[model samples]
Target: MNGVDPLGTGVPGPREARARARAGTAGPTAGWAPGHAQANLIAVPADWAYDVLLFCTRNPKPCPVLDVTDAGSWTTSLAPGADLRTDIPGYRVWEDGRLVAEPADATPHWRTDLVSFLIGCSFTFEGALDAAGVPLRHVEQGRNVSMYVTDRACRPAGRLHGPMVVSMRPVPARLVPMARRISGLLPAVHGAPVHAGDPAALGIRDLDRPDFGDPVVAEPGDVPVFWACGVTPQAAVMASRPPFAITHAPGRMLVTDVRDEEYRLTL
Candidate 1:
């Protein structure tokens, strides 16, 4: 519970190191640590962690778990000394399926009964897309990834069950297959597109209105491609109304000790 602040009060020593380790800061060590593994964050009651872990296990495409914290433990041993309470840039608190607050740190609300889950994110695949000459409109426009709750029901586990949430990226008709191929290699991070061509087929009523993130132009000759999203877990957690739940804000993730290449072989 007593760890140094990352905001530069002084040269970080052991306590600071423990704090940094718990925070899961990886990438760009000059200002922040680089090449360190980054992961998605989910905080739930210890009672719920078991079901959620089972949910993630059943639905690996959408909820690929990277690490889990022991009940009452804040240090991220899986990712090396990262703190789950304060490492991320932001946190979202949900009550009964609605977001109540976005806090900079979860320390004030941290509970001994709480446990943390680190999931894989599609951001891990952005570099691969750029390398393959696919353009990500949201990244280019400085917007959050557009996500939607789909008609598709994820394989239910225990109390966790809900429509799959997906992130959209418009690809040129000619390059849609290539984009799928590149992403298909990384199944732990949502794998390949679940649906391509018609958004209505997935029960997405409007392309202009998204459940999360900014709407991007599909453009001429572009097709809307969807990937199972980490947000699916958040949505399920919210609907289950587990008394208390915490998750990373959109676009914020737990940078980790694992590498993106690890995902390519996880399946």
Candidate 2:
């Protein structure tokens, strides 16, 4: 790959983005690697792997499974030669359902009994909406997109259960339709907005405060659009309290080699 600005918005290709991410210098990945698919990481003990995968299978909207690594492997087909232990800009180490550490490099925390899952992230579809002339407030403010955990519960699967989490993007009322239409085509990446206009409908009482990510300022006439977020798995770990787990810190995604169009459905 030719040299490019590693931290420039919409500049670096997937490989360059990963290189920057691995260095822990890339800022929030909400809009990086424009055309590449980004993913959420959730690694659990081998014994808990099947349950996690089943949870994703049962709750596809908030937990769309993109790739799964064999127990003990850190590399994924999503990004050949990429190291799950350190490629992402950030990671959350969990023990008994509580966040124990926020590490940029998780290599020292790796375990042979762990199996990793890469779930579809809404960030992968931001470029689509951007191309459609839809406004993205988080990208505009250079902030992490807001995410909230809802009162809505996901279908429980063997040993795992939790509330669904959603990412919020404020879109101009008129462009809401275009944003939805374009994003709805990419089901692999959380698809269409699960809710728009009212945050209370999802039990989110405050638009100013979010469970994960920084809330951005919404412009007048901009409606809050909510989409199923990949962070739901972390919510699961919080609720289920597995012995141990590792997940991508909210808004910090694994930039994969897969192109975003690969997951978009045609008309």
Candidate 3:
């Protein structure tokens, strides 16, 4: 089944072909699609694209951008044949800083004035952590990574600004340095731990509560290690109160053709 146009005619481009092939598939293709890249998706107005792109450039720790699409173009040449409109399993639409809806596909909301930005996700670093034998609680429990909005302000770029959001993974105090070493190798996916000991230092006052995703047991002798999360852009978009914005729901990343290792070298 090819991608049917709004008019009901089947489109025959490379994107259409891949969309037809990978349709209805869901979840992180991690371990399955070995060496394939996974991206974080942020779709906002074309007018905001440049400012947001600059925000990404300035705050590379949280918004490591992988690619940007021309206004209204859903096909990403950087991640060939992947259709941004429907490739991802879930999407969240925000209006006036509130979540309006979450849909499995965003084609219905696609607009010529809309532009897509693909950011790097920390999921790219999971392979490295697993390779080093750092057990991730969320992955073991089949839950999403826990995310918190910190009082730490991101360096503002134009109107794109907000508190930094960090993803927490509880590590044995002994393995904290190992985890940092493994994750630091991929800077594009948010390198190193922004906060390793007390969440209070980063203004994260609660450990049981998270602004996004599921919370996990820190366990005795386990220290919560935090990394600047890709979700930081979503927080910024909400704070900016853009007329319209779209982002992948937490854990539902935009899987790309770029490999995880590619991020290790200069991005």
Candidate 4:
């Protein structure tokens, strides 16, 4: 809260971060509030809650459930005073499974029947890697981390079924092992790298082009690392084409009161 953000420049803490996010000033929570846990947002009608829960249960890596709000409630235990309707920097509104709007706030579309979910995000682990002296190119360049939809399919749960999505980071070859070990401690935040070294094995043909978020050039001797992404749920919603849905924009995340250390598992 006092020093510069882990990414270098000074950014807001949880409260200020959410405030800036609601005001559309903060771009992404990547390096903001380094010690705090960041979350992915997904809201759906009560009718689809069971299916969604099952989907998350079946695919824990990409959809680790941090908190699930009661039907019609936008408030979450993650941030008691914050409102999900406006705290995120950006949102994606879906209708009939198609993204209809990308807005700064979704208050205009908020409904009493909607249930919001908070999913653990890889941003938490990125902070750990940074603290351990691993520099993240996406954050260094002030861009969203590159995310891609892979050929691998997530196990279906009821009506939700979609391909897996992964966020890519270029780690110096010598530091890849350290990066993996540091991230592995936080299982609640997508854990360790799902794949490293080769993008082709994951069906990713071009590292310069991504399905979501911005792309960063991998320098010579940099190994491409991939982690299961929370965006996988958004892809599921797109494939399932639910009647209505809401999700956080690519890099925008729900800054929570929880600390990143709370998510680090001993095993």
Candidate 5:
């Protein structure tokens, strides 16, 4: 019901988005390929792979790992025939926990010792949310979703540790419950809203000044809703200082071949 908009939105289906990304079209992927499961990418050295896996296991909400690749391998079951190094629009290259480069194609930076993890992304459920009549302000405004680092810290695993990061979406007050329930069905993609009222409750001070992504404007009666973000791993990379790592640029994601319904739970 997504790529084709089963709700009769007449939106074309098929994941040509990856083709564009592979061809070097760099940008965030909020509404790129409807109905397809999108994922967050993070690759670390083989030695640090277990620590990252354990971290994701400990912080499932923020790091719902969909797939993990063998050392030096870029292919994933999530998207057959797709190359991890160049399929995503953009990538963040890190050295000693500090970001060193933002590359369109990570093939040059790819290493034989790196292992990649594909984490579930909130964008995967956006089609259902839209079909349910929930507004997507960032999509409507052509902006990336707003994300912030909170005071809440994640459970440490081995060498990986950091505060939680959340993506904020402004939903109409009356539709907040509907929004929560719809997203709740996709547990792999950070199911449900973590907070749905005051940003301060999460220690996020200024809505306009987010730690990552673009700040979206809210229409009248809209309330800010927060969801645990896959970017939490990147925050950990920044805080814990992994020797070397690569990640999908904030907001940009790996659009997998898996359908949105595959991860959906019947209510």
Candidate 6:
């Protein structure tokens, strides 16, 4: 973390997080670098870029597009010096719609014809909920937030289409409303809980075994809150199976220089 500003602003920033990732010391990015925005990454061939972009636009809630890099470029305006090929702690390599590898660095698989996209993440709103005194079960238990594949299907765009995926957070019944308000302010980060209190409504029969990420034990009096997850695009891409693709490992994200406040959009 030498070149990274670990103490800048008296808080851990994206650079520090990326450095930890590069050093192979980084774990889940959910609780790290509080207050800074985190993003989900997906890289695809230029030929599929239009469909991917359209897929995101059609499913804004789950696939909010933040920053997109030019073909073959690893750099983005989100993080000046960060390299997309190596900054994330983990990467998932997919072939023919099946996940083939989960590597720490994607440098070896870098392609000159690839187009990378940064999608809004729900992790960015966790800090706000923490500040508001809302309990986060996953953070408290040191586990990744639970995510599930819902019966809800996203609007199809070209060759991309799949069920909507969501991240589940157990918020206290009393704080559920407050959580919505606090998170609702940040549209760029998958703002607010799309559903609360009923897991069955989303086709999540057992919360203990999630479709992705770790199961967060819901405590007494806690209600399960669901947010549109960035992973939705990965699911869509996987179902469509674009021959070759790469995405950040579930729960692992690319921390960005953009502050959480920057994503707060208002009418």
Which candidate gets the maximum lDDT versus the true structure? 5
Rate residue 14 of model 1 by lDDT: 34
State the weakest 10-residue window (summed lDDT) of model 6. Answer: 1-10
* Candidate 5: residue 232 Cα off by (Å): 0.4
The pairs that clash in candidate 3 are: none
* CA lDDT of each prediction against the hidden true structure: 0.74, 0.90, 0.77, 0.89, 0.91, 0.87
Q: How would you order the candidates by TM-score, starting with the best?
A: 2, 4, 5, 6, 3, 1
TM-score: the better of candidates 2 and 5: 2
Q: How accurate is candidate 6 locally (lDDT)?
A: 0.87
Cα lDDT for residue 179, candidate 3 = 96
Tens-digit lDDT string for candidate 5 (148-250) = 9999999999999999999999999999999999999999999998999999999999999999999899999999999999999999999999999999999
Clashing pairs in 6: none
Model 3: per-residue Cα lDDT over 1-267, one tens digit each? 111121123333333323532575444322323345567889889888888998998899989888888888887755676778787767889987789998877888788888999888887777677777787777666567789999988988987889889989999999999999878888888889898999899888888889988878766888999999888989998888878988888777766666778778552
- TM-score per candidate, in order? 0.83, 0.96, 0.87, 0.96, 0.95, 0.95
Q: The CA-based lDDT of model 5 is what?
A: 0.91
RMSD of each: 6.6, 2.6, 7.0, 2.0, 3.0, 3.6
On a 0 to 1 TM-score scale, where does candidate 4 land against the true structure? 0.96
4 or 6: which has the higher lDDT?
Answer: 4
Where model 3 places Cα greater than 4 Å from the true spot, the runs are 1-34
Assess candidate 3 and give its lDDT.
Answer: 0.77
Better of 2 and 3 by TM-score: 2
Tens-place lDDT per residue, model 6, 1-267, is 112222233446679888878878545777778878999999999999999999999889999999999999999999889999888989999988999999899999889999999999998988888888888788777777899999999999998889999999998899999999999999888888889977899888999999999989888999999999999987887789888999999899999988888898766
Give candidate 6 regions above 4 Å deviation.
1-11
